[model samples]
Target: MSFAPYNDLRRHCAALGFGNQWTEAACALGNERFAACPHGDYPRWKAALDGLPAVPPAFRMREGMPCLGEDFQDQQGLADELMTFHPWRKGPLQLAGVTIDTEWRSDWKWSRIAPHIDLSAQRVLDIGCGNGYFGWRMLDAGAELVIGVDPTWVFVMQWLACRHFAGDLANFVLPQGIEDLPEQEVAFDSVFSMGVLYHRRDPAHHLARLHSLLKPGGTLVLETLVLPDDQADGVLVPEGRYARMRNVWAVPGCERLLRWVAEAGFSNAQIVDVNQTTVEEQRSTPWMTFESLDKTLDPQDSARTIEGHPAPRRAVLIARSA
Candidate 1:
């Protein structure tokens, strides 16, 4: 793994005068964890990046969100190289002339949450930020810096490959999780935990940790799978899997989640939006060749999962640390 980018990040933090425990911990974690993890695809991804044709030092969020191709290189070859890192879950990234139509239209989710937040000049932390796709959008929206953390090494490689094309900036994704974050680091202006809460076996504990990571009065943006209004008082602990995802632990109602937020000591917790995920939002594409939302839902009834649980509905909630 290249520690050059991590070194650059350290320099960037120093230039910004951000000498906090979070910065120190992040730099340490990035250096240690990323170098130690020996993912099977790491070398391949690195080789692809090394072989990538040089592009102009420019990237913009126009056309679609966070696109590359200003310098324009071997279009088909670059696309083929990018395909080696398959099963793309987050974005619809456009290379020089090829468009990687990813499984999830993440831009829609961003649209739902972006209008409600004040991101300009904020130092943000995005948990479970797959490939740092949203981090680029956050930077484009005027955020000062975005610290994205995810434990998946494959996703980290994908983000690195993307960074090769997008050029260096303030966005940095550490190959770590929320648990890897240092406790008592209250430096961020905002923290986002999208599609992460339900995966937690202990939602309250997770919420408390999120609260602890933020400064007093810092904003928290949380998005997660949810139950509908009828099940507002109930929390669905799936017997096995929900929507073919084995990690799903708790699917709570919006009100129940708000209560969890309040119990975690966040103020003014409210649900901003609720949208049922459709095939249009999440489906199989060439870039991501796997069973998707369509296959996860009941063929007989789209309103239920294959396991006979409620269909997938996601909610966005915003709160402030007290």
Candidate 2:
């Protein structure tokens, strides 16, 4: 809710020796998008941010958990204030003293990814980076800086919660989507598009956007819902909804996924890790009260969603920009 975040980000970009014009444009976009934020809950979220204790900013990523600050005015009150940003989708973060068990055990996904990509000293971009959780993980993996974007305002609020404890850290989250970013070819050293491809109406266009964001031969870390090879011919275009998620436009088979990336000007597209989503990995917790994977799948069959579609299976593919 404050311009301080953008200011810190701009200064960090400058310190990293990024192009002045691009950094300025990015800061402007961040300010503009935040100014016109349409989320009705913005006021309450801002108040929650304002309500946080005036603790010294300190951040450390310990064992995949972003630990922020060491002291709090009131632990219970701090927890209550954080609860205002409910339905926390990504975390298990350590905020001051309060531990937030988020909906997704996102660290598990990161474990599957960290082994495949080399992010040491890389300038990275993360699309749909909920509350910048992976940004910390990426930072720990040795990325010099991580610019994360997510459309959801609550996630931005959550990032602020972490930022409240992180003084001028290189990890930043802008309240914008990947499409909203300025088109800068050869911009980042690595680009991550996770849990996002299936939601795009045109996955090819999405891939192109990702390609344009990275430098030639820059690493591309893409994680998305993928169907088994035998399940669909090429891509599965769900008739109604997939796993009660209406936005899922297409779930491609592993082979078609490679083809899409190949046609999008990416080279050496390879499936690095593929794992079926489990209820234990994603379920409602005290911090996220809504129903999750447990209720999304069929009670009768573990391998099928309640909608009778194949159960959720995700894949992490590593590619290089051509």
Candidate 3:
């Protein structure tokens, strides 16, 4: 898989001069890790990328969706080629006149958080960035550069698909996780960790790492599943699967989460928006033909998961590092 956009990102940082040494190092490591990747589907994803017809990289963002390429001949063929990489989880993206109505209405997610943060000329690190969907919104919000890390090779391929049409935009979604990247304490002006907290065994530790990644007085935008304060324990350590997700460990109450954030050395931690996820927000579409949120909910009680846990209610917290 040719990670040309990532390489272009490295070059862009290098051209900016000596201050971006750490970024350069991370970029190099990303390249190395990507090359050494053992994912079984990497070749398939790469082949899909190879199959993308080169219409001019006439990309733009409209209403938060990353629109890729101009309308060309063989529109149905382009859509079919895109369908090769099935289960597109993070988008409702536009590609060569094909509107891929993806599983998640990611534009809504971006809309929720975009109003709370100012990314103008900021350097950002997005952990678990899922095909870098939010990276486009971050750049659109005036972020100077956005580096996103995700472990899934498929999402990286999705990002590559966008890159093929968009050329080298400042947003780069590296095929690596936050844990895999080289350490650069205080490297970012703003850090975002959305929908990734509960998956970790140590929520506080994860917050701490997010704290450490930011510059002095830098912003931390954290979003994760939360149990309602009045309805559950301080932290709900799911005895079994929550919402059909086996990896989910702890989902904190509003107060408990804020306390954890404060304990992790973030100050002025405040909930910006809290919303119970609806089926419309995440459901199966033609582009992502698989079980989705609709299947995760309890049939008898939509407000509860199949395992009887409270249905997904996510909270967005904005705080600052000392």
Per-model CA lDDT versus the true structure:
0.85, 0.87, 0.85
Error of 1 at 138 (Å): 0.5
Per-residue lDDT of candidate 3, residues 1-322 (tens digit): 5554457887766665524656777778778867777888878878888889878877678877888788769989988888877879987788888888889998998889888889988889999998888888888789888889998878888888877877777888887777777765446889999999999998878888898888889999999999975853488889989988999999998988988999999999989999999999999988888899999999999989999888999999999998
Q: Write the per-residue lDDT of candidate 2 for residues 153-246, one digit (tens) a residue.
A: 8998899889887666899898888778875434789999999999899999999999988888798999999887685347888999899899
What's the candidate order when arranged by decreasing lDDT?
A: 2, 1, 3
Model 2 Cα shift for residue 22 (angstroms) = 3.0
Minimal lDDT window, size 10, model 2? 178-187
* Winner on TM-score (2 vs 3): 2
Which regions of candidate 3 are displaced past 4 Å?
Answer: 1-5, 17-19
Candidate number with the higher lDDT (1 or 2): 2
Better by TM-score, candidate 3 or 1: 1
